[model samples]
Each structure stands twice: as C-alpha cells, then as structure tokens.
Target: MLIDSGSPGAPATIGISLTINGEVRELQVAPWTTLLDLLREDLDLTGTKKGCDHGQCGACTVLVNGTRINSCLALAVMKDGAEIVTVEGLAKHAGQDGAMHPLQAAFVERDAFQCGYCTPGQLCSAAGMIAEGHATSREEIREAMSGNICRCGAYTNIVDAIEDVMHAGAAR
Candidate 1:
C-alpha cells in the first residue's frame, strides 16, 4: 500500500530501515522523501527543524552514523540501515539522569540562542563536531560551525558554548 507523502501529490513508497534515536523503525517512504521530512513528518521527530528546506540553511542538521549531515539534502531511501540521531536522540543519549547535554546546557549558560529556531541544528552540529574531534580551538569551532546560520547573530556565544563542551568532553 502506498502512503501519502502529506504533500499534494502522493508519491510512491519505498521501504527503508533506520535506527533513529536508538529505536529501530521500518517505514515506507517516497523516493523523493528527504531525510528531514522523514524525521519531521513521518516519524514526528519535530526537534530537527526545517528552515530553508533547500539545504542552504542548516536547520535540518542531524547525525547520520556519527557524522553531521544536512538531512534536507539526503533522501530517506539513501540512508536506509543508517543510524540517525536528531536533537531528541542527542538529549536522550547524553544522560539518562534527565540532564541536558553539556553543549545544550552550555548554550543556555552562554546565551547562544535568541529566537531559538536554529538552536536544535546548532546543538546537533556542535555535538557531531565534538565527536569528530577535529576542532579544538575557538577558531576551529567557528569554521566548523559556519554551516549552521543563526540569524540572531549569536555566533560568538555559540562558539563559546561549543568550546565549553569541547573542553569539558576532553576533561572527561
């Protein structure tokens, strides 16, 4: 049975398996279904925001197999069998103690967000960057996080928050 893509045109469905937020989900997705839509529309993981929807904005960022990727640019079928982590998953993975991830907490402490629309993408991207272990300095973090646009102009605070987490992670 074909499922509606929630768009005006109901596209044909293709089966895909995704391990999302530590849960294995098997679903039928349209060939044109972007990973962002799959998460927000199909799975209802709305934490991963869809800002530009054209991959220009990093609002749909998520981790796929421990690497940061713009979910808007990826097709759901292309990520079959891949491990996906959205903001919700990152929060859950950080601690079962019900505390926020260090980066998330740092963001708040540093006032890294204004309107908060880009916070999810920024947090996920920073978490992934820390996992990548390639960025160690403030300048490096700035460069690495350039893809995520915070229209609120909180770049300095965002970098500060990310740096705080990176240093803390290093200590642990």
Candidate 2:
C-alpha cells in the first residue's frame, strides 16, 4: 500500500520490498525513483551503470525475475516484490576458491571488456540473454545483444565470449 505525503502532487513515498542480489531489502522511496537510482544511490550497489539514462543505451540493464530490463526506465515502486539480479548477483557461487559464473569467466578469457564502464550492464544483459535460450549461434548472440552498446569496440570479443559460454551450456 502506498501512503502519500500531505503535499498535493508529491510522488508517493512508500516502503517496498525487493529481492535484490539474492537478498531481501526494505526501502522507502518515492514512486518516481528509478530502479537504477534505488540500486546505485540508496543501496550502494554501483555495479549497474548509468549511461544515456533514457533507455537508449543498455548500460542500466538488470535482470528482473530472470528477464533483462532497463533499470533506468523502471520505477522502483512498480517493481516492489520483484526479484532483481544485478551484475554483482550474477555469480551465485564466487569467492577465493569458488568458481565464477561461466559468463564472467568467459568475459575475462575472451577479453570482452575495456574501460569496464559498460561491463556490469553487459554482463547482466548477457546472463539474461543466455537464460532466454534463443541465441544458438554467434550471429544470434550478436543480434540478441544488440541492445547493449559497448563503446570500446569489443563486440567481436563479447560475441566470442558469449559463444563460448553458450557452447559450454553453462548459462544457468
């Protein structure tokens, strides 16, 4: 339930519960707060990048219920109770000895990133794309990943890394 402030047109500020990065969080935010701002500003999860901020660049991509969405375009109040997976959450088992997610490892192995500003969003989007089970070839991966813009010209390496992961069948 949203409780509005006494102001006439103030965006309702309400408490919302979100399952983010495998953890449940309770937060009070304005109805207009974007999920990206909630993650970066409030929660301090800076992995998701803020690029164009207009949904043109996929830098704010995050997985909502295993589906990739532009966090910048999604209102936090609307996603209350939704399960979100940020780049930091892509690897369920990761530590000094634990293995990283296949995509993560592939990205490193193939040198899929440069400057790294877009790496987080690219990683999250690729994870969700892999889970969709539609990309079967390099071309398919490229097409599916068209939304994510990597300004470093690492498209070839990114495609190669995704292909490697897909071939290994380790998207999950």
Clashes of each: 0, 0
Q: What tens-digit string does per-residue lDDT give for candidate 1 at 55-123?
A: 777999999998899999999899999999899888776654577778888999999999999999998
Q: List the residue pairs that clash in candidate 2.
A: none
- TM-score of every model? 0.91, 0.91
Residues 18-108, candidate 2, lDDT per residue (tens digit)? 9997899988988878999989988888999999999987999999988999999999989989999888888872221356778889999
Give the range where candidate 2 is weakest over 10 consecutive residues by summed lDDT.
92-101
Residue 103 lDDT, candidate 2, scale 0-100: 87
Local distance difference test values of all predictions, in order? 0.86, 0.86
